[model samples]
Target: MKQSLTAMALCLTVWLSIPVAFAGPPHGGNPGRGGGGFFDSTNEYRDAVSLQDLQERRRQREERGFERLKQLKWQTGYTMPQHYRSDRYKVDYNYYQLPRPKHGQQWYKVNNDYLLIDDDNTIIQVH
Candidate 1:
């Protein structure tokens, strides 16, 4: 009975120690002992500034594109540029609270304006 108890105690000790052995070093085992994660250095600040500058440049480029679109004087009788005729620019008239287009006519959204174009790519109207 004593031998059996000794064996059980040894088994329990080994079982408990197994978890501690595999637990690994505390605090992620960082040799430098630095606990701060990700944004923990001066480089992080530089990265943030560069990211903001990139965003600003993107905004400026988009504004320039919109300005270019606005510069085109869309007359009623003139044909619209070919690029604007793509399906991507097409919009539903009812969704924009505009009047339904006549046959062979479709509505297109360019920047903030709505343009109605005919099948021949002529600018029927601009709103």
Candidate 2:
């Protein structure tokens, strides 16, 4: 019975020591592994500032675009911007209650308004 108790005690001691023997570095495992030891506050702050700066720049760009659109006065006989001539801006005349464009002309949407432009990029009509 004493020998059996000694063997059981030895087994328990070995089982407990196994974890310590295979333990990671004293400062904990690699930070990338999320072992939780060291943290760089500066990096975190820089990342946050970078994200905020990107958002601010995006907002400013959108504001500038809106301002530019507002400043434009789509008058007849004036040529429309080349960007508005792309197929991406094309709209259906029937859906928007607009008149059918003649041959060589297409209906395009610029912001909230619709414009009828000819192949020459001329602003035929604005609605």
Candidate 3:
């Protein structure tokens, strides 16, 4: 009886070891659903953004920001590192002893035209 049980167990193990092949290759290789069969045809679009493209995008963004800053400086006459009047102030010209926004509240540049203030004094708009 023990030998019969052992044989049955061995048979069960061997049956389990047989790989159950599906009707098609695993999901990643077929376009019918999940597999990468989609690559069978070539198209204009390609995978992965090149580093050059990323750098170009970043350059464009920086240029746009500089242009915006130039326009703002001309319109507001407030240049950085020179301590211009912040919107939180009532007077146009005042000493540095101004009530600045509290901690956690960053100075927000509004509409790229004016500065907007929130309850927390965080700048919400940047034009």
Using TM-score, give the best candidate's number: 2
**Candidate 3 regions off by >4 Å?**
1-49, 73-95, 99-116, 120-127
Question: 1-127 in candidate 2: lDDT tens per residue?
Answer: 9999999999999999999999875366466665543554555687799999999999999889878976888888888876566779999999989999899999988877788888889889989
Per-residue lDDT tens digits for candidate 1, residues 29-103, read 443555543445655787899999999999999889768867887779988887688999999988899999999
Q: Lowest-lDDT window of 10 residues in candidate 1? A: 30-39
How far does residue 117 in candidate 1 sit from its true spot (Å)?
0.5
Where is model 2 poorest over a 10-residue stretch in terms of lDDT? 34-43
- Sort by TM-score, best first: what order? 2, 1, 3
Q: Estimate each model's TM-score.
A: 0.46, 0.49, 0.25
* lDDT values for all models: 0.84, 0.84, 0.47
Over 4 Å off, model 1: 1-67
Lowest lDDT block of 10, candidate 3: 89-98
Residue 105's C-alpha lDDT in candidate 3?
35
